[model samples]
Target: MSKSVLVVLSEYGYWAEELVGPLEALDEAGYRVDFATPTGKRPVPIGVSLDPEYVDPPLGRSVTTAEMADKGRRLDASSRLDDPINLAAWLPDRPYRSEPDFLRRQEEYFRALAAELSKADRYDALLIVGGSGPIVDLANNGRLHELILHFYRTGKPIAAECYGVACLAFARDQENRRSIIDGKHVTGHCIEYDYKDGTGFEGTDFVIGPPPYPLEYILRDATGPDGAYIGNFGRETSVIVDYPFITGRSTPDSRLTGDKLVEVLDKGLRTWGFVPRTGVVAPEPAAAGDR
Candidate 1:
């Protein structure tokens, strides 16, 4: 039987191509992909063909019209969340959103999701697809931390793209702290792109660009030592591979990111000689430091 791959989404309306691009690749590789969200129902791909501007440039050349047509059909069909496994139950409402507080809730959510993952023995890897909505869900949700922890512990490959990488924020190490992303190489929507076009939709100062709200800066701040030179950051070109965890900058990097994820899963499964349990050591922290 083909290996099972779990794909998680935040909301119904995300960039359609991000999920579709990778799903197609994994499917072609003989992997059975199961979609999930905070709720088990079908998620809405926020950016669809209706917006010509957001159509991925690469899709024009590599993605066929027939494929997109099928995707549109499937997308339309997923509106009701037919069989969702509720993510809300697994995750906690922020204890204090005002204080950047999600500690207690995350612990609760993570444990529940971890339990579910343990029962899904068929899955060999976890793929977190990204879209604009991640800013609203995947980035800081504690339950996602639990999800990441379970997969990471089980020696399964944990892959994400664009904002999906934000899920890494809540991931804890042996010391039970944040996983640092500095010097390890990572990418996502840049501050410039967010501010350039995402402001009105995301709201003023909603993003981390312009003068420091961009994800890069946020990640930089979150990872490096206190007062570390945040200005000396790079790794911004996307395509950061740390093994067991693969991340991309934006939608454009989805194909490569997905392909890499498959490669890692294939290798990880083959190397273990058996499925790895939860809590397997992932790639060494991007940098060894307090998170």
Candidate 2:
């Protein structure tokens, strides 16, 4: 049976390579990919991600190659992103405590959520694309939090790249309010990658100078004392697979992240990107064209 993946993207803006990389990998693996957005809007790639001449500040090089830029533009123009699943309508929202009949509404909310989550069974994996857009839409999104929690609880592979990884840290059990990745190895956008200025997403009038928050710090804390956040600093790219969760560090790790997720599905890969479960410092795996 061909496996299917439920991919969640930010409507405001998603990094071009972040989607193209993993998407191509998944397509090559013959997996059916479905897309979902917070409000069912067509997601657009950030302008910089499609600009081949735009050099990445931290990397000091052009991360988007001409070929990759074309691919990104083609993908954006295609019908793949059309009619994305509307998360707001598909998932149930928790009731406010002050609402009338709060107790009954709360119970109903949970029941409805259980039913909606059952839809996750249709997918073998879930992916959250990364970009500055996620900070505005995907992060701290209650509906998305529930969906991520559902995928984790079911043992389905959950893949997140860049800022999308923030959703994983935010998706915690209501009772404990602890991060779902509380004791799981993961990686995300490090502090150094924060843009010095003009950090913006689509459908926005203004840009937040630098990322509003540091994802590295949040991941470090979310991992708790036992679980470690592997920044893999100085590496060309970073992709870590710790059981059902596979995380990528940034734009460069996009395709690699998709490849690791495929390994987790096809080869039952459970652990990687760590030295004997240590915090990090793993060697970079050779990419397809590297050799």
Quantify all predictions' global Cα lDDT against the true fold: 0.58, 0.90
Which RMSD values do the candidates have, in order? 9.2, 1.4
Q: Could you give candidate 1's per-residue lDDT for residues 110-163 as a string of tens digits?
A: 565556666656778888887666667677766667667777777677778766
Question: How close to the true structure is residue 119 of candidate 1, measured as C-alpha lDDT?
Answer: 64
- My TM-score estimates for the predictions, one after another, are 0.67, 0.97
> How high a TM-score does candidate 2 get?
0.97
Q: List residue ranges in candidate 1 displaced over 4 A.
A: 48-50, 53-74, 78-81, 90-117, 173-175, 180-183, 197-213, 222-237, 267-291
Stretches of candidate 2 off by over 4 Å are 288-291
Clashes of each: 22, 0
lDDT of 2 by residue, 1-291 (tens): 988999999988999999999998899999999999999999999999999999888778898889999999999998989999999999987889999999999989999999988987899999999999999999989999999988888889999999999999999998999998988899999988888887988887878788988999999999998898998777778888888899999988998889888989999999988874567566666663241
Best by TM-score: 2
Instruction: Tell me the deviation in Å of residue 4 in model 1.
Output: 1.3
